[model samples]
Target chain A: MSAVIEIEGLRKTFRSVRHGKRVAVDGFDLLVEAGQIHGFLGPNGSGKTTTLRALLGLVRADGGRMTVLGEPSPELLPRVAGRVGAIVESPQFFGNFTGRRTLRLLARAGGVSISRVDEALELVGLRDRGDDRVKGYSLGMKQRLAVASALLKDPRLLILDEPANGLDPAGIREMRDLMRSLAAAGVTVLVSSHILGEIQLICDHVTIISRGRRVAAGRVDEVLAGHDRHEFLVRVAEPERAVDLLHEAELTAAVEGTALVVSGVTDPTVISRVLGEQGLWVGELTPLRPDLESVFLELTGAGEHPSVPRQVDDSALPAGADDAAVIDLDVRGVDA
Target chain B: MNLVRAELERLSARRFVQLMVVLLALAFAVTAATTLAGSHRPSEAELSSARTQAAEALQGMEATHQQCLARQNSMTPPGETDDFYATDCSEFDPIRQDRLPIAADYLPGVFSFEQQARPLLYFLIAFLVLFGFLVGASYIGADLNSGGVVNLLLWRPRRLTVLGTKLGTLLGTVLALAVGASLVYLATFWVIGQTAGLGGRPGDDFWRSLGAIHGRGLVLVLLATALGFAIATLGRHTSAALGAAAAYTVVWELGARLVLEIVDARRPDRLMLSSHIAAWLNGKVRFWDNQLCTSSSGTDPCSGFYSLTWGPSLVVLLVITGGLTVAAFAVFRRRDLL
Candidate 1:
């Protein structure tokens, strides 16, 4: 597979008189291959939008290298721009223009056939409301119109930033299906969102950014597996005795309520034999596999601890850590 | 070319531009109605009586001129030369027959295209110039403010091309509208002249001069539109261009004029932008400057009249338009969109 989008050492800083200088993105790298639905996951203000802006040339990058569809970004991005569809942010349209008029103008500007306007509108489920002015449309309808605008060129690479924003649950599902269909049709998709569950479901490859740096990136299962400790929840008569017995067998074990959570188990027979001989009687044993959300929280420093199950809000971030301030650890084993 | 077409469509779609077009049509209708109400053709008897009175007045003026010329040497002072008392006799030259001060002429018997059209054309030009500026400003201003430019750039990806096409579309549309409006204005006034009043047919020179004035007016419209577009593009909002215009009027036109008047500056109109614009539109303008007097005594105080011609006016207007346009393009090209 060929690389459709690439960024290395990308750096950007915003400056204002009142706020002085603040780094928005620092040394961020991303690689998206052809025909892959790559999820770009990050916390809020984690430089996801800044990286996308720099890649699309909406904003200037202070330093770094970026490319889309094999062309150097910004300078050479125009060369391949026709083949790339992007929605940098939630773009606002002229209030008076109808959705159809807006898409037709974009099609004209992109040198695409005007006939595609109808098709694009249909694809985004905005065919019925295409003649209505944009201002009257709801936020979800505007999002659909934006998607229609992006699809005007029938581009091979679609870069959407927070595409699911302002979308209802059904609209989000439709967007997911649309992206999946696009990927299945040989178009590479780079979708950035903070919705981890959606990313986990729709994306085969994932790149998680925290605090302007890539913390982990690979297949969704592999990234989750890297943070997986291979633990098990055991239900026994005596949870305390089972934990001590598991500890004597050189296994890490903890007692929680009425269950014994044991880690580093090579086989299930060891737990049955060890606990059965002690008359503890293992009633049930279940493997506790890691999910994307837990891995995401742990890597993003939004979790209390890996062993303790907690919500994202339970962890307290350090002061001034809103700007990502994440741990930079790369879990390799990703296919090039 | 596609980008230009897109921009043209977008510009025409703006409600403000449409409102301006409606206003222009209203102005034309009002002008025609007012002009019709103020003019009428003279009756044969009224014409004869006016001609007789004009002839008598001309005879009396010639008699007065002859008497002055005859007494010129006798009225000379003791030490002064005879020529000093010889006033310019040409000032007493008989008025042309066409320009005779007949009651009908003064009471709007004939609609002289040469005389009436200049002011009307000036009114048309002012209206169209205002229309161009506001339309141009709102056209680009709404785009930048609404992220339409960013959306266009995503498709086109050539920032310069996008900005340039928008500007080109604005100028071309403004020029076309101005020319069309001027034609309609002239044709309507001509029809009025032929229908309800004496149609004084002007010669080729009058047509040529009128054409030239319209041409200058069209250029002024284009320049004003381009300036408005450029300023809005730079500031990324329509209010930016409007604010700048207001600031210039308050600070330069009013405040500086008052300050210059207080200081009794020499040729203060030289630094005034309104003066340059007036000179550009009217060919040339003459302003009085008290500072140019060589002798300030009561006996013989000299007055100075300075003319600001078309050359300097064209240069000043072009430099301002070109400089702002280039700056706008440069900033749009290099600066971050967000």
Candidate 2:
């Protein structure tokens, strides 16, 4: 599959009087395949939004090779801009203008049909309030309007920065569904958000970054399974005896509330066998898998990773290279 | 072109713009009504008193001139024609000289289109110029203030194109409003002039001069709008432009004039922005009863009028506008929208 967005060695530095010199993006590389909902994840101020702005030519990067829709960006942004709809940072509109009027202005400027204003409004579920002035709109409504604007051109590539910001659960769900539907219809979407669970559920592919560098990226399941150790929830009547029995067999096990969390073992049969040898009847055995949130925290070094020693600062090896070796890893300690 | 059309629609539809237009129209109507009321003809008793006094004074003057002429004629040879002596008494009729029964020359009447409309024209021109600047400044200022430029730039992507289109659209709208408002005032004044004993139809020359005056007013309006657009774009806000204008007029210009008064012999107030703006339009600045010019006589050196060469003033105006506009464009093209 062709990449919709590609970036290599992207670097951006900002100099301000109050903040002095700060590197917002350093050695960032990203690739998003066509027809996939790609998640661009990062900690706050980790350069996710900066990269998107640079891709859209809103901010000039110091050094980078970037492309969108197979074309090098900025110089060719205008050529491909008509087929790309984006909302960077926050949605801003003329306060005095009604939502419908704002859309009409965009339609006129973009040479799109005015009739699409109503359609775009309907798509975002804002048709009822489209006639109201934007200044009176709530923050969630503003976010929905931003989504509607991104969908106005029926763009093949949609770049949205925090598209679910200020949205309630229902609104976030609607946005997720809209993205899924758009991707289903062969549109490529690059969405950045801090909501890891939502990204995991909505995005087929994810590229995780920390300190302005890509730490891990691939299919969501693959990334989650890349942990160094496997884990299994072995539920038994005597949880303490189950832990001691696993210790005797050289298996790491700990009581997590009511269940014994067995780590460093991929096969659940070993856990069952270890417990059954001591006459400890196994009530249930459930395989524990790592969630995207835990994987993100571990890669970012913001959360505890007892099994894997993260070396994000090591320049010799590629980031996340150590985790790529494992097909399954222990994640029983991670919450569902 | 469609962008220009959209901008025009947006400018015209703005509430402030609508309010300004309504206020301008009300001002015009009030000026017309007040001017018409003040132009009421002299009372019948006052006219009669003035005519009787004028007739008596004329009879006295004629009796004296006739006696002097007769004495001169008698002193000359009978065969020689005294060409300097008054040969006819028919020209001394005061009633015939005072044909309109009122001082129609100073009042706004049908025949006084050129006389009375001159002040109204000046007032309209000044008001339009000031308001044009305001409208032009707010046009881009509101966008920057409200963060609308983010979406606008995303939609268009060409910064220079967006700026150029907006400036063109603003200039076009200001010029149209200036011309349209001028015509409305002219029509209103004409209707009011007819009701005030104004009966004669002005000739083509008067209409031509009126058109030329309005044409110059249009130029002034364009200059003000350009200045406002340049300043607002350069600062990225209307308040900046307004603050700068206030400083220039109140501090820079006034302070410089005061300093020049203490250190220089020349009248430096003539170099103020207000003076230059008036000079650009009027082609001269009138030094009305000032200490600098009241001591001098005639229309020569130190005269009551300082004529500004139209070509040089026009060049100065364009250079200022173009310089600010270029500076604004350069910054706008490079600066990142954050």
Query: What are the per-residue Cα lDDT tens digits for candidate 1 across B48-122?
Result: 776788778878877767766666546644433344323445445565323445444444456655567888899
Clashing pairs in 2: A229-A329, A229-A330, A230-A329, A230-A330, A231-A330, B110-B198
Each predicted model: what fraction of the native A–B Cα contacts (within 8 Å) does it retain? 0.71, 0.38
| Chain A TM-score of prediction number 2 | 0.89
Q: Name the regions of candidate 1 deviating beyond 4 angstroms.
A: A233-285, A302-336, B45-105, B108-112, B294-301
Give a tens-digit lDDT track for model 1, residues A1-336.
Answer: 899999998987776565445666668889999999999987666678778878988888999999899999999988999999989779998888899999988888788999999999999999999999999999999999999888889989999988998999999999999999999999899999878889989999999876676788889988998988888899999888888888898889999888888888868788888899888888889999988888877877776565876442243333345544433211111110
CAPRI rating of model 2: incorrect
Question: How do all models score by TM-score?
Answer: 0.87, 0.80
lDDT of 1 at B37: 84
Query: DockQ: which candidate is best?
Result: 1
- What DockQ does each candidate score versus the true complex, computed on alpha carbons? 0.41, 0.20
Candidate 2 C-alpha lDDT tens digits along A1-336: 998899998987666565445665677899999998999987666677778878887777889899989889877888888889999877777778899988888888888889989999998989999999999998989998988888888899999999989999999999999999899999999999989899999999999876667888898878887974688887889899889888999999999999888888967788878778878888988778888887877777666655766443322223544433211111111111
lDDT per model, in order? 0.83, 0.77
